[model samples]
Target: MSRFPLFAMAVLGLGLVFLYVPTLLVIATSFNESRLAGVWTGFSLRWYGELLNDRQFLNATANSLIVAGLSATAATALGTCAGLVLARHGRFRGRVLFLGLLATPLVLPEVIIGLSMLLVFVAAEQTLGWPAGRGIGTIVVAHATLAMTYIAYIVQARLTGLSRECEEAASDLGASPLRVLTAITLPMIAPAMGAGWLLAFVLSLDDLVIASFTSGPQSTTLPMVIFSAVRLGVSPKINALASVLVVMSAVCLGLAAWLQARRGGKVLPE
Candidate 1:
């Protein structure tokens, strides 16, 4: 019986290795001195240095960061408001329709979403003469649209699980609804909001399909640039860029985890 359990553990360990070994290989290959991505000649930081000097890469990075930051902020605000309405408003009319509309992007194919947004932008530019062209603004709007649904879902789940007694108590103590929301509710759900914001940021940063459709020629993102580079040939500089992004993603995730742990505190339930 113990032997069987040990065998199962071995299989599980092998599964983990299969999943993560490729990722580790990518990280290791990023330091290769050779221009070839797969063939490692020796460990070197030259690729990283070259990546820093690439103007196109730098421009793409700046564009990605700006879109991610702006879209995440807008999405978080919209999603939090939507989540609060869903959680607090009891049996409002058209709630089902509202929820379905909000969740459409989550279930819809990315290709469909990108195409639809692109068409809409084209239509608007032709008819209304507004947003005369597609660029960063278009990309930001597209990203924010996708991100809002995820944030709303996260926040709604968090709000549903949280205790309502605290809000009720605040209400009893002559606290206005807005006051209670700003002080008690927001503080308690801060962790969820932070998580949602980070998630939105990552989604926007990583998006290629939607950004490709929505962005103009001059506003190409990092992923688009990398994809173009990969089409030409695999370069160690690309790997180095990817390694930097991986580190950034890990740091963001770690920070979110820390915030969650701190908010929950060190106490264990008896």
Candidate 2:
């Protein structure tokens, strides 16, 4: 049992293949000359050329990027605050209600969240005359609301594992609470914050239902466009787009990790 577990290795290999085989195939099919998936002709980049030229796809891509960036930033900010409060504070009045609000999005279905947000926006606009109409702003708010829970969970878990000795030592050294937070607390948790931001970005970029509910005319995100296209028929162009997204996600994560490591202050205190 202490030696190599042949059966476990076999299972792990199978699991990896099962998970990544389809992704590899999709990437390969994106370069295929054929429009269909099963029939792969010689390698070609026709679909990539077409996808870049597609006006609707370009517009949707822009919209998706804008929403993802704004939502991820907002979600991370709110979530970090929520996480700090939950993790640092002991029991307090209304703490249960506060926790419930933070956790609600994680438990509830996306469809329900989208619908509820839509309703809230509608009511607010009718009464308060803010937001005038649904569009990028509404989508950003919806995504932020739906995504902040995930960021909160990440930050909370990170904070839970972190040693508070650093902060305590800093306080004893005459640093104010805010100084300790800015210098010691924030640096230790920077990696988690970055990861949470990336996760939120991916969620907002990949979301379709919530975005659909909140999106107004001319505000369609990439997923919405892709969904609409898929309804008509699957094309190699979609595969091309998927490959692009996969590559872009990988690049972003890798770049963030590299930057974090380069900064060199995020390590946990011994």
Candidate 3:
């Protein structure tokens, strides 16, 4: 058993190094004086300054933030509703079909989802004269679709772990259905909702494949910009941008974890 634990720890350490070493290298090289990413002559913050001044990168970052914020919010709302209905209410007609459809985006290839959404946009624009054309709006919609699945999964898991007795007690105490849901159900599941939102935000921010198909010239997201830059070759500037994104994601995920832990401590019986 001691040997097994040692082996497991070694395996875990190896896994962490594999995942994080490349990122650490990128961050380190971003400060290297040499333009070539591999060779480091000396450290400098010039690339960071350049990135801050680059109008195109700035615009892409802003667009990404807007899309992520909107998409995550929308996905969280829709998913929370879907999860509550699925968990609290008994199985309704077409429940399995509805769930399958909702989760299809989660398992489906990004290329396929992007192509399908593009086709739908084209059809809608030509037939209904809605959407006008593909741009930021379409990208947000695509992101929301995928993000909703993640949110739904998280919320559903939390709901499964929750006791229905709390809601019953609230109702028994003369609380209306809406009041019980607002006061009991929503509060109980808020941590899951928060976790779902953060996941959605990261997913939207990191997305490139779907955004590529949906975005127009005016709405290039940060990931798209980084991808285009990387295709030219690895640059310190790209490394700097990637490092910034990684830090932001880590911070967001950490906050989500803290919130979840706090909620769990409060909710679980002593």
TM-score of each: 0.90, 0.88, 0.92
RMSD of 2: 3.5
Decreasing TM-score order of the candidates: 3, 1, 2
Which residue pairs show backbone clashes in model 1? none
User: Candidates 2 and 3: which is better by lDDT?
Assistant: 3
Ranking by lDDT: 3, 2, 1
lDDT of each candidate versus the true structure: 0.85, 0.86, 0.87
How do the residues 41-139 of candidate 3 rate in per-residue lDDT, one tens digit apiece? 998998999999999999999999999999999999998988777677788899889978987998899999999998999899999997897788999
Best by TM-score: 3
Q: Which stretches of candidate 3 lie over 4 Å from their true place?
A: 1-9, 265-270
CA RMSD per model (angstroms)? 3.5, 3.5, 3.1
In the range 67-131, model 1's lDDT, one tens digit per residue, is 99999999999889887887778898899999898988788998999999999999999999967
**Where is model 1 more than 4 Å wrong at Cα?**
1-8, 264-270
Number of the candidate with higher TM-score, 1 or 2: 1
Candidate 2 deviant stretches above 4 angstroms: 1-12, 253-270
Residue-by-residue lDDT tens digits, candidate 2, 1-270: 835688889889999999999989989999999877788789999999999899999999999999999999999999888879878999999998998988888788889988999999999999999889999999999889877887777677678878899999999999999999999998888887887788788888889999999999989999998899889987899989988888877776675556446545232212
